[model samples]
Target: MSKPSKSNLKYKICSLLSLFFMLFFLFPSFIHADTSLQGYKEVFQDSPIIPFLNKKESSKENNKEQYQRLEDVKVVPGGQSIGVQLETKGVLVVGHHQVKVSEGAKSPGEAAKINVGDTIVEINGQKINHMTDIKPIVDNSGKENKKLQIKLKRGDKMIETSLQPIFDKKEKAYKIGLYIRDTAAGIGTMTFYDPKSGRYGALGHVISDMDTKKPIDIKQGSIIHSSVTAIEKGDNGLPGEKQASFQTQEKRIGNITKNTDYGIFGILEKEVNHEKYEEAFPVALSHEVKEGPAKILTVVDGEKIEEFDIEIISSVPQKSASTKGMVIQITDPRLLELTGGIVQGMSGSPIIQNGKIIGAVTHVFVNDPTSGYGVHIEWMLEDAGIIKPESNQNAA
Candidate 1:
């Protein structure tokens, strides 16, 4: 204590300075009171973590309004692709699949007649799905990499094929290019367009390979009719899954557009007429979006159409597929109380603002159902490759 070290002296000086700074910073609050909201804003932004705090705070203030919009969802005209999904009552998805090879074994995939992304439904008069279901097959097939026969369903097309596995020297195991999915998870919209251009897709965002969780190849997919049998709500901690039946009737519309974060798209075989519906209006531009209020046109509880109020949070300056901007809040207690905010099947619901169709609800926040993502109507129109791009300000 008689002789303090240099490091110790520096530490004490720093500590005293820190105390002085703290007192100095706090003195202001003593002079001028800080509001509660101000404290929250400071605490939120000043914190090292909580990156999205500002966004959340902004949303909390912007999305509450009554009588905003719930106008009508109308389909755009001139879309002509007959792309449709085969309806199914249920589908099983899994990974790392094995199948049988017919009488005279055909080449691997041909023997199984399986496409790269086809969901394997059954094998050898057996409904092969989960790992436990094929434990016996794996044990039996382990004996030898011999040819085998199997039956498979590729969307609407069902076929039989032969398969043979090859042993990999590095891994010392038999390998087949077969992958499977045990459960089909996603929201699929039906379309009336089917094109022979060897082009069609569903779930605008590609279906993931259950095993690797990668996008599956769509060029090999066949359209199936999946009828909605049950729908689960998309909410916090649990993203709702949509289930449907695979039916044979090949009813569909439009060429498939690329899968987007906003959901899937296809050329419309039949336009959903926003104009024909009650209170139909012209679609609005992103620049025209007003933050006060709006309504979304959607089908809830099988009613085919319903209206609800929501506030527009923000809008973009340029056109984009995801352009319609707004952090909408459901003002209708009936909608909020009955279904949370946005539901799964509500993906394509149209949002009308100021007598113009502007956006479609795309996704629901898993944690907050009432809050979700919406795609600008212009993006859908552009994806169709039909709607002409608007002229820029210079042209105007």
Candidate 2:
């Protein structure tokens, strides 16, 4: 019942302090339990919690970025013949002729300075979508003796002109002496098709008028199955062409939605069969294309889609979009002997290299039928709107 000595008390206090220090070092989590609430098992400056949270946030951002990427994109390589029918936005002036009037032979369109290749979009504030749409306006304006206010699209410019319709004695109707066409049709090859979306692209170049050489402004059109009837051999100075006959109504393929510099795009109503390349294939970026041997899927004769050998003479690693990205030459003796190299209607033939679709044949050299220019598939895919293009990036 007596008080302890100071030395013993000091020793006991020292032992108590030693025990507290040991326990704190051994079980720091139990001593500092508040650390758990802050998402940390250990109370340290470089705790793994911060790294884990940062990693999780980075992973979420990466997932979102990958969702919009084109790494999973695959397309079916097209090689069959397609008959394209393009209806213009309005009646296109193909030529100007003299109208035989009672007074004299004169051309109202020529007098108004309305050149050929101009698309007449409106007449007297009435929209003209077809060649037939002009007759009523012409007749009414002529009977009233009113000057026709013509609005047209020439290239990217919209122009307005006034033309006075003349009474044609030969045709017994009012005439502007402008030969206009509302529709154009031709045969070309298919480039690629996204099987998942049923969207397709074809004719690696724009469809232009033979006389005016201006890109056709498409309003609405369609494509149908076509059979190659014959092939004209190409020469150094002359380009060959494929003569194909469009199939019947049952062969209606798809409707043309857009006609761009990269070619034509549409949603296919039915799948286009590729006899050899039946499966979807991946496409290469422009920088990935290498100069070497390659193969092209195209029809040489009849309805048969065949593979032909070709050489990639050169390929450009483009930082921006371009229509011509590579130089190609026909090396297949069979193809050379058959079509005399890259001919017309073979513009959209899929160019494959190293098991990847690199591009499509765009144009044949006028001086060298054996060699031609090919466009990178990325540009065509971007124009087709299959993949979203990044700003200043070569491809999506």
Candidate 3:
């Protein structure tokens, strides 16, 4: 080949440099979207609910000042295994199946333009609070040959539509052709418990429906005792998991009052004993978190809470609330050997550094099982109502 022109070579170098810079800035966000957090599997069960949170915000300056004043707030770090059961405020529309009727098979819900992830809050002017509440109204409407007016909550918008129930010849019951669920149950470690407020935070992330992938709009929920029975070690491209069972007979330790982007928050009915740290301690703000050695409290065997060493590979002082505020890697040989790094059901395991709780493990890197994401403790506290509750509310 002939020698290339200097101008052509310069242009090629510039293009290559631009590509490198673009990938450098874009790679982390891409990884964030792929990082998987453990603990959002739906289990059929009964659960409780949470109250509406005030999401009004003050000015940014006021917000900073308010957070500064919250430095003295103390919380008991939680690492005990717990079972979470959440019931949706109204029955959720997860999917639609064909209803076999005398006329033929059809889906009334799909025909009505009721999409999956919609929450049916009312039917025929009657409020729908449970799956049981829907059947009676549907049956009556079908018998009366009347179209039912349905009110649904889709995201932040409330809309209405008409849906006619079809009579099934085989079962002789009216059907809407929508598969719905009211409750979701799973296992996770608790992040913190504020004794003074009886409020606790856990999971370090939202509980989304497995099918719809939307946050569960809880009517009520409960957190019961749980035990870690087994672990599936993590590996490249495959995240590990903590296999656990709920202590059903044991009284619920707390009631789930809120499910937000940060985590689940609720009022504790009783103290969660068996935590590694018995006494309440201060929490480091996002700005206070640093890149250094840290400890994480979690359960690898049974109900026993144990501390494992980890390192804060990087920490960011966030001006806005975010779930991935810190990058962490498991440094303890025992933890690495036993679990192969962060696993499912360990999302809310508390991360302590320099005697202060700084954050909780939230997600695991799919490509590197040894490293994961940590959310700043301040955001969890805010979600738990232990600190500034009026601002930055993204509750599910």
Candidate 4:
């Protein structure tokens, strides 16, 4: 080819230089992210994150916070659902002794008569007190078309049922498509307890499937000792998340009583470290929380009590008509740097107004961490079995 002229060559060089600058400035924003994420740097600081290779820290803490064990969860008089993703295989019980079933098949996952709350008592004449005892019978039945008879406890009555086997292509063997869980796991904190009645509540929301995002069947959501791995603070623009390792501990911390927008309720099987408990942080009256300054007691940032400044943006006595009665404006910087502001896993944090706990931070407006939802303590207290739903009733 003939030699290119100087003018043409310079033009080509300028064009290439312009293209390089454009790519350097704009490609990152246009590049599709392999993962959907929310985090914060400084304002106007647009640095890209290089994926870190280190594994997150383990979640268990040998030192528990000094907490006050209340007799009952004070009544906010509100309520909430259940899908919990389970890893280890176990006899799947839906609620309070309900076992789930599939449409057809005679094996582990089959049987139409079995309802969600029926408790599986025995499998193939073997006592199925726990999951380990139940899975093999179900698995073997699927593989060989073996007839597996399952004896279960429904309410108080004992019933025996058999499931036929079928092949499941997903497992490359005979299968019944039944999800199983001995219990669910998550990173949640206790909100309050009632000393008068021995009722307590924690994790101010329903535990659900991370994937399907559906509430786990209540029967399936018995608590387990969850290991919280990492924690981020709640902040103005970003939200916080408690990364935890799911672990199963049979030590019953408590029994679930109810669930609502205020959170879930459970009664302690026995008193937790009573000495470790300090007095409960009282919730504030809606009428008390105002448009000035307030603080939040949060477990974000590794279970430490980090306080933040926020404005009671607007007080809607019944905004959700479910839980939080007031709205807030998160105006803290440190919290914003950690959690954009009320992110997942931050639900149930007590919003202290005038030194009294008024509400639990329930949700962060997706686009705005500075603004989010709060459930009134009164409703939470009622749902947690702290008091009778109609406590202020006239004597009959």
lDDT of each residue in 14-99, candidate 2, tens digit only: 99999999887878867566555344422422432122123333333423431124677789999998888889999999999999
Candidate 4: tens digits of C-alpha lDDT, residues 179-278: 4445555566555555433465555566554443544434423443344456665454566667655434454445564544566765544433322234
- RMSD from true fold, candidate 1: 20.9
Residue-pair clashes per prediction, in order, are 77, 0, 5, 69
lDDT of candidate 1 vs native?
Answer: 0.48
In candidate 3, position 285 carries an lDDT of: 80
Q: Over 4 Å off in model 3, which ranges?
A: 1-68, 101-104, 389-396
All candidates: TM-score: 0.48, 0.81, 0.79, 0.55
The C-alpha lDDT values of all candidates are: 0.48, 0.85, 0.85, 0.53
State candidate 4's TM-score. Answer: 0.55
True-structure lDDT of candidate 3: 0.85
CA displacement after TM-score superposition, residue 180 of candidate 2 (Å): 0.4
Off by over 4 Å in 2: 1-68, 391-396
How many clashes (backbone atoms < 3 Å, residues ≥3 apart in a chain or on different chains) does model 1 have? 77
